[model samples]
Target: MNPSNQSPNHTAEDESQAVVTRRIQRLSLHLMAISAQNYDLCIVSCSSRGKLEVDKAQLSRYMRGKHREIQERVFEYFNSRPDLQTPVEILKDDHRELCWRQLLGLVREAGIKPFKYVAEDPAQYFAIAEAVGSVDMSLGIKMGVQYSLWGGSVINLGTKKHRDKYYDGIDNLDYPGCFAMTELHHGSNVQGLQTVATFDPIKDEFIINTPNDGAIKWWIGNAAVHGKFATVFAKLMLPTHDSKGYSDMGVHAFIVPIRDMKTHQTLPGIEIHDCGHKVGLNGVDNGALRFCSVRIPRDNLLNRFGDVSRDGKYTSSLPTINKRFAATLGELVGGRVGLAYSSVGVLKIAATIAIRYSLLRQQFGPPRKPEVSILDYQSQQHKLMPMLASTYAFHFATANLVEKYSEMKKTHDEQLVGDVHALSAGLKSYVTSYTAKSLSVCREACGGHGYAAVNRFGSLRNDHDIFQTFEGDNTVLLQQVAGDLLKQYKEKFQGGPLTVTWNYLRESMNAYLSQPNPVTARWEGEEHLRDPKFQLDAFRYRTSRLLQSVAVRLRKHSKTLGSFGAWNRCLNHLLTLAESHIESVILAKFIEAVQNCPDPSSRAALKLVCDLYALNRIWNDIGTYRNVDYVAPNKAKAIHKLTEYLSFQVRNIAGELIDAFDLPDYVTRAPIARQSDAYAYYTQIVGF
Candidate 1:
């Protein structure tokens, strides 16, 4: 008998269901670990309770198991209490002092020790964030979101020791620190930074100065009002190496005190001012910083990777400056991953609101003049279900990526580290951009009410809009991934033996040219297109073929045109291919989990979700198929049929869909999404 056939002694289900149940339990455990890392103490506390209670019976009845319902109930219970809910309201009520106080409270709760003077221990901060679910980090990120646009870096990219010293008091709300790296003229090119740290051998100190206004740090988060210290990145100039020229001695980190604790005045060489507010995240006082002739102890330098001796000689364990810089860049990967998860959180909140509202708000049609819920409409299902599916997709993908990232860190695999970094950057760009767009669509799906601040969609949109640009702009990040892919293609193909690339090229060419393959249609029955596995395979094949074709085309183009020109010409196509690859990865992972679902009802619901995800992509890429001879007109008709079928299937599952999200009534705070009885009662009370 297959292992799946083995029955649990207590339950009467067959082996297949048992296996799926076990798989779900395993996956749930995995999710719990991720939640522990991503959520604060409050969130983790609630989620832990829910996880313990999730059961098959509950899962069958509601798309979400009992655990999810418990999670929702917990939210409802908490939000009903004035104290917890009051803080959220007050924080939103005032964007200044009250908000800061609330933020301080959250920071403390998030494990920042009170009365501390600095954030010298970055790991402790990360540990606290992990322990508390990063609520404070989110607040910090939100504060920096808008400010980052003007150029301040909120998340510090510094070593453990540097954080221990300069960041020590910040945890206790004592001495706040800002991250300063980008110069007015330098932007993303850290290599071109002109801030210099010269060795003063006589005094045994490092003299730090900005060569000009262009070299001044233009955008340092929390600099204008909050920060009293900074983690400054600069070029190290050796005293005796004057004749050797500035040979890229690698970027070194340093701690510089910039403000007087008692007077709150700028130190002798440091100047600061607030950056005026604009689009969003205006609460943070992002500002500019100028360093004149600031002198700090030689030991103030963060000497983890590179260090200077008292004699003014510089030495580094890493020989290559480029590799060292890349290593520094590597530290920012976590932020990118964090941003990806944050984007998912934003979407979750939006979907919860939209789904609940859809189930409550009623409109036209009559059964003895009864109003039908908006979710009853197929059009609404088409608009919202794909996004709902995508939330799960992103959730699963990010969880998996985080797992891979943790494993790589543990093993210290350089190649794995680089790959995760590149992948995280691309995925962050893809997920956040889509989530932002989807949230807008979900907002519109809610109609006029969605635009109201009280409805929460508008605020959610405003808050998430900045995610697209930060953690490196989406366009720039994706372009980097494309560049990496192109390099891989060249390395594999440009050499003497082109075995792998040639084989991929041949297979893709055959598929594109419409050569008949048995496996291609094996899964396609009269209703094959409707089969969830068939749809998944289609995404897989389509993505693989697209990537192969693009890689080959770029390679061929490189032979004739200059490398730069060829890359420029192929940029759009390459990025699209990467997007398709990512989509396929997400779809594949979602399908694997869905296939492992034990409850038949859940399997059915997830199947519809899977179909909706695939159909959405097909709709977006209809032109691609239309231009290709491989896809027949009949196949095009099949795509539309799949869309219509999935749309109807989604409508049937909308109530169940909302249940799967498990949003609490209080967090939603939308009258329409509340239970119908409550909605009616509230409407009456308000005289609506």
Candidate 2:
């Protein structure tokens, strides 16, 4: 980054350092993977199959079929129209308000109505919503805030009366709505909100009041210029029988109109203003709002779980206060799951751009030889191929999550709700964290041209940065997942059977306990690397051991700290547990996807991506192979070598692998990725 280091020769200098740095770093890990005995677990390296050309024809149909077909149609339709293209183009231009309005109008026109699709085919509906993120997170988020957040509240929490009033219009995007939840002082801590909705007996209405500056709704999409209403989350101030104002009935959702539909103006008591320019999602028109004793009909409460009567009496069918709160929250998991799943699509776009650019961008090679594609370097492959592998991993994991969510909607099972919440929270945090890193890596992978706006990596890097914080902050979501996981672990300790699927924690615990003493851990080499069962054994064993260690740590911490304090102290360890579980889930789900694949060619290609994912993760966290002797330390070194070997294997098919994402030029929108046209494209655009 030194100014004097900004010459063409410096590029090769930096690339050399990067390659050497990776070697030094891995050599350090190599020792960690080798125990005092230097035990190693690498068989024949990548000898399972001879150089098989990646099945490009099958890969073209890799992510195809009905859902992809559906996505393509929607993408083509929404992307084709002149007006719709204008909003995306205007995203980088001035007049942020105009861009958001254009987005809202086009969301309606494109029939990206989340509420409409949720009632019929929810997965497809969610898919279309996610497909939007692949193109532009700004527009996707605007559309999602309206239908998924605002209208989703009505569908999930409201009875027939509320649905009849809002569902039809919400479906067609006739009304733009926002989910008013986070306050200036409260975001992840929904329970700490200061906004109060007091029951007024005189008018039989609820008075929504923002008592202080901190209580003002902040970062609300659609409120700046477009939304007419919001599904507001606030404390319910219900009077007790003793006439005391408010009970501890907790936070609830209420339908509050913020703007006059025709005028698009803030209502009398609703103070609204734009949040001004932000780092990304510029077209979202984010704004803040403060309510001053705004009154709405008592029925405005989305009262499927809790309600107030004409006499201002609070009521609910949920057996316990906890049940009522959980049920209400159950209605909102879709947002988390949607974001988690949607991240996969976004990651795909990023991976496509980075990989394509790497393949096209060449650098120093052997003396007197032609320059090599950057991807041909082990250092460059290390940067992008793993991210590509994770994109595939998340793709299957999130797909399964979407189906589980649909089942939860149908059955309304509390058990499923709890599990889904945990899974989605973990996946959302892990995937987005991975994605944020991927965008930056992708941007850097392209070197200088990556910073160019026309290549799309710059906007993508900026836009994806916020995705880590929203939906739910990554750290908070991971903590929640960790907490949920620990609860299950505790239940198992109390003699209750553990109930996790595929990546079975209980069975893993039993296996680890039975083999407390290490056997001569002989890794049969590269052939064993191709065994999904062998990979799962390593992953599952690590997760089980980490969970056990974390449990012990928490128990020990409890002796000195209060429950919350003990938990707070163990947050980092808990995150480790959550991450371990997530990595296992990603691996298990990917293996399953390939095993269940009917197409031999596609399966063969996906198998390489899957192996790369597993090996790459194990290599990076080589210490996972340490601590417990279930796997030998040298096996970790083997994993590192195998990952490098798998990287080469994946590199052979990198184009087809990315091509499987099916991102057309319009979707990728990166000039460098245009291969033969890169020079002409950047020349004309950059006026070089």
Candidate 3:
């Protein structure tokens, strides 16, 4: 819009509304000139110059789900504050300081108290976390460390005494703390940690110590500089009845003071070292810590599962150490849940940027005609359309996860807890791995422009790379999912009722235990391939077959090798099985979302994207389907064609699809992702 044409009262919101108005006008004019058959082609042509018409408000409402208002508030909060946005090429220390300030800004300025909401309102807290992550992941991690990890550990594991004494300070950031869990030698294997905390009966304190170099707490955020205290996880030791030595209990968490609050110096018995500059997320000051007999009162123990008396005798209701350990870690699964939620938001940013850029970037086309959008090219669509589809799929899946977690919190049902834990683990692994890989694909799709630091793909990719490693490594997490599935598989035979997540297993196993009928296997109609039922069934068949086959393989191998060796031999198959199960879960949730969508237009759009996601996944793994004769060659070809067809359908509405993400231009911080006037915005930002 021309500056001269604007009224004196014009605001940024007004200009944004004008852009949408102009795009819709353009779309309406083009639609009037085209027939139904040429509608998609017309959209492809019009998109180079203008946006396509979509019910963006309705779609955005649906995509944002229950937390739309909170998310929008966060996005607007950051969008209005230029100071909060990290400048390109800032020093590491400056970046870390910025992250800390940004987090504080969200609390003091935006009034987003994720720490309080962690227990009071989990959904809202995660919504805030995701929005913050979308704008700046450094801030996201910093917030997670302070609220979700450190503060959450105290709330979930510590009792009323801990909450009364510490909750107010942690909430106000007066007592900055870190979650000290991972050690130099322990990343995923928390049980193998070597740090020891022996109860001192004489002093009525727990003496924390790092027995060896490998036992030092490593990669602890908020430790090197900002943290004053730490929720240290160490093996609890009690004096044996003979008084000759100490008996080791399992891992336990204690509130150990790491630095003096007033002096801002490391405590006498504590040592801290900066982990140095990292490949990404340098805004977070990762650090390592070692304790030389750090002592804290016996009351410092987070004794929800176990505790020691003043005399140093330990007592717990849980009979076994393994149960105590499981219970301890289960309470801390919120980290994985938050990561899965935030990872989806990060993927949304990447998708919106890349897809919008593709629409703006015109390139080679047919002879004697104007250059066409790269998005119109079949190859480009192939690269990005399914990615867009999967983003939506993951959104709904994660939303369901968030809902389940909230439900578990309210009920504390044992089965519900296990379901939430397993679901979070699987989704975190699958989604982060996909998002990490997709960032590179997105960067490459944007060509050299993506490589430029100003575009943000570099920073986004770098910061998100660690997500797959932290919150439990992807490989280890997936193995846990597979193990959970195998347990349910065993229960199915014993006539035991399945949990809500794996309830379909009983029927699916019975049906898929036999081969699919010849007629159904060979059917190749577009309607058949696109059917949600058929897609879900295909996914279920793969998961069920893998479960059965892997079970047989494990049992056969157990004769020659012990159970551990058998599991090691079948690790690859187990990972695949776990991935298949997660894929099925995602598809099922996507279908449920489409079925329940209130707006017809939004539902139709979602159905198209769902088809693309389902068919793309099926086509990618066609080899397995073909091997079992589950889908004949002709049917497989049909699935491929329909997948491509659905991609084109999605490409027609790609603008609306991305807009539904509802990220402001400032939040994306990419010139190429501007909603309107791409050339003008790009040139102005680039000083061309």
Candidate 4:
């Protein structure tokens, strides 16, 4: 917009904020020149007049060069694939079969197989798949089910024999598979499943059976038509010498061939039925299966941690039954981590659509003057800017998660594994929950136009809604995170420099114990918001206070209700505590990213985003902060104003901030957000 057309009410603060935006862009080239190791420490002195030195060359790379290449490849892959271009807005069972097969062919042509990623790096490959999700989450989920779930299980839970046997076909989509862990009677409670795998010594085989109707596997993706095999989770039933029973052995996975590859018919004793149309992502062939004594070779079991001897003895490398259970559960983190990564991908699409539309869309205006873009409106700014900030926050958090998981997968470090499990659980729940709320906001921000599928907002929303429940239910996952935090608190886990959660806890404890008046020493307003340590302290204090409150409540109630009863009663509060801890983790990552940018301009821009994230979160929970005496009413007011200031700072840089995400026009495809003149193309199509 022309500066002359600005409202007379526009003030000095708005102009200064605009300068901050330009100043941030100025350092981008210098930042790009800095080595990755020293990028974080890139600090430059202000000129005598306090103006930033502007450089036109592109220096700062928002993402790693390789990852940026990966993102562009995803956009290119979708745009160039004619098979995938067909609108899947609607499809019947038969059409879905064709769509699924077409999807397989397109992926093959793109060379985006799950096995290719598995061979390179499990964690990194999963992250890249998530990046691909911004275009089509259904395909992402289908691939996730094949590679991340089915292929993931083989790699993580199975031995070399299983990997060598299935990896080739899985990556090539030759031996398509389904992961059937969720039963009709059980979604979150795996141990409660009643499917039994009985050992038949005479036949030297394991008979997989559904003991009752409730044991049937429900929502098994790729089972309706595409999948020929399934990774089945069932109770390992063994003959007892005395009063011991089969349920005593717990759950184990078996490689069950569901359908005959040639006939495309269900194996004898296995009843399969389609789950039918879902709220969204109908492209996946989800089905249910009931096994009536379906027998398979004993060697079909994916034996890495556990095995059955020739003499019919069951033994495991894991120390205890719980450890065995946890080992299996731990391998599933790849999916959760990918879900979190994909949640950010989804958020980027929503923000891009909303922000670009608002910029071009003009509405009511001053008398005898040109109408203003909706983006100039405070309401639109308030709605879209914070969501944009959050998408960036999730991006950094996911990158951190990917690195941690990759490191853990390589070294098999127990501490890193435990941390990854705990982190993925909380991050997945938190990121998906935020994405759901933010996507709705983005949709509503676009007015009635957003409701139409052609705009892509409605479909994106529908497809992503399942993310809250799938992989793992967000609510149940948060509870597990709470349980983990409580365990960490009780154990008082020690933290070194790199240990995230425990390190935050340790700092909080030190502040409460060592510092007589930590709050008194705190800087006011922008100074406090800009300090990385201050943000960490704010997050840590809130988390610690909530954790302490939970401990007290549990202690008080447990005497009468018992530990289980107390825990059940306090689940809601525990969820909040976990939420606060996760917010802290996110803030810490954003801070790290902010501190590490070597270019002054780039660092300045990122700080604005990080500050906005921290301030907005703290503002939302101002009541909680006040209740704990963490912030005075006056201090809270300053924090609120700082959020507004940060919002304006972001407003000036909003276009460039999204440009940093680098989504091409081809992938977005919305006429309103087209790379060419969006208004001209839109008017040409609609004749408006």
Q: Estimate the Cα RMSD of every predicted model relative to the unseen true structure.
A: 16.3, 8.7, 13.3, 11.0
Please provide, for model 3 over 1-688, each residue's C-alpha lDDT reduced to its tens digit, 9 standing for 90 to 100: 6888878899879889999999999999776555334645645654453433568899888888778888888888887888888897899999999998888888888887788889978888899999888878988999999999999999999999999999989988888899999999998999999999999999999999999999999999999889998999999999887857889899999999888889998889888999999999998989999999888999999999998998777889899899999999999999999999899999999999999999999996544567889998779999999999999999999999999998887889999999999999999999999999999999999999999898899999999999999999999999999999999999999999888889889877889869788999999988888899999999999999999999999999999998999999999999999999999999999999999999888898898899999999999999999999999999999988878777877888999899988888888988888888866877887687
TM-score (all chains, Cα) for each model: 0.77, 0.90, 0.92, 0.88
**Distance from true position, residue 67, model 3, in Å?**
1.6
**Model 4, which residues run further than 4 Å from truth?**
1-60, 243-247, 493-499, 513-523, 683-688
lDDT comparing candidate 2 with the true structure: 0.79
Q: For model 4, give the 10-residue run with minimal summed lDDT.
A: 40-49
Clashing pairs in 4: 28-60, 29-59, 32-59, 32-60, 39-596, 39-598, 40-596, 42-598
Q: What is the C-alpha lDDT of each candidate?
A: 0.63, 0.79, 0.91, 0.79
lDDT of candidate 1 over 53-114, digit per residue (tens) = 23334444433322243334334333444443322233422443443554465445433342
lDDT of 3 at 668: 90
- Candidate 4 lDDT at 594 equals 77
Highest TM-score against the true fold, candidate: 3
For candidate 3, the C-alpha RMSD (Å) to the true structure equals 13.3
Q: Which stretches of candidate 2 lie over 4 Å from their true place?
A: 1-50, 60-64, 86-112, 241-243, 514-517
Query: Over 4 Å off in model 3, which ranges?
Result: 1-53
Model 4: how large is the Cα RMSD against the reference? 11.0
Candidate 3 yields a Cα-based lDDT of 0.91
When 1 and 4 are scored with TM-score, the better candidate is 4
